[model samples]
Target: MKSIIKKIFLLLPLVLAWTACNDYPIDEDGLLITTRSECYVSSFELLGTDQRSVIVDVATVDTVAQEIHAEVNFGTDLHALWPQFTLVTDAKLEPKVTGFVDFSDLDNPRQWTVVSGNRKVRKTYTVYLTVQEP
Candidate 1:
């Protein structure tokens, strides 16, 4: 009986390890397991003054390698305008940036929130826009 008990204990670790991995995610809020969307900004562009003109991509304004950056003409209105965004990995933007956005203060960085398609995770990104004055 003692030998049988020792063998059971030796096999217990292997059994636990096999059951550790699950095909589904943890259910904390009663939600089923689903594929989590990856956070990525595929395309970022600005609208031109001409309605029919081609869209211009926003470029980096900072010295460091930042994800989002843009350069705009001086005296441009930062408010009442929205940037066109193309996302990947089945992601969505928070605060519904599809509408107008306010960036009146260039000193402050703009915060954009990206939410997973499954609505399970949220991540924030900073956008820096530099004004190019002639």
Candidate 2:
């Protein structure tokens, strides 16, 4: 009876440890590993000074060309507008789209790079904006 209790105690920890083990992989950042590699910009939006969308129509996203085009209402201030992007699942953007960014220069379009979840693929996209004619 004593030996049986001793054997149970010895096997309890092994069973617990085995159950704790997981097959799921994790990256260096401690994020769950994924195999998805599809990376692209699905949508884009530009915000006005009042924090409202300045886009005149649905922004055009050219996945094949890796470019984005948006038209803003006439007289909309583009100097300090904010840009937002929607990307594929498990993908991330570089130059981290944060607070207001300057899109005042139309000739030199803004560029953003998207990285896949597996960190194996990258796509750089150019964004162009035009003001609607009054």
Candidate 3:
């Protein structure tokens, strides 16, 4: 009985070590690309002169990285008006942050400008943005 008890204790650690490393491979330096369309479009307004504010919520996912960066993809009309839009990600502010697109002038408007005429308008639309590991 004493010999049996001593052998059992010796085998316990070996059994645990073998079981701990099942058939799982470790992957730490893997680059993952994820897409999300769940971001909410809250507001869009024309800025003073040649800029527009597009407010949109940042996507939240359980597997997303802690410090995420995004790139904006505007639609044909909106994109034409302002080809470049600024992106900001802040938790405290609604819609996270405002994207700035330039649409300051009409007659003298740059080559790519949406026709809004003289009316100050605010339109809301879900923008397709790209978030990737950078």
Clash count for each candidate, listed in order shown: 0, 0, 3
lDDT per residue, candidate 1, 25-129, as tens digits?
544444443587666666676554342212234454321342577777666667655667676566677556566667668788777676665667766767777
lDDT string, candidate 2, 20-122, tens digits = 5554556565665568899999999898778899999899999999999999999987788889899999888887877898888999999999988777899
Evaluation by lDDT, superior candidate among 1 and 3 = 1
Once superposed on the true structure, which residue ranges of model 1 sit more than 4 Å away at CA?
1-34, 48-57, 60-66
TM-score order, best first, reads 2, 1, 3
Candidate 3, superposed: residue stretches over 4 Å from native: 23-25, 28-134
Please write out the lDDT profile of model 3 over residues 47-91, one tens digit for every residue.
Answer: 222454332344322212212222332331333232332222210
Q: Which window of 10 residues has the lowest lDDT sum in candidate 1?
A: 48-57
Better of 1 and 3 by TM-score: 1
How far off is residue 117 in model 2, in Å?
1.1
Q: What C-alpha lDDT does candidate 1 achieve relative to the native structure?
A: 0.62
Ranked by TM-score, the better of candidates 1 and 2 is 2
Off by over 4 Å in 2: 1-33
Best by lDDT: 2
User: Which residue pairs show collisions in model 1?
Assistant: none
TM-score, prediction 2: 0.79
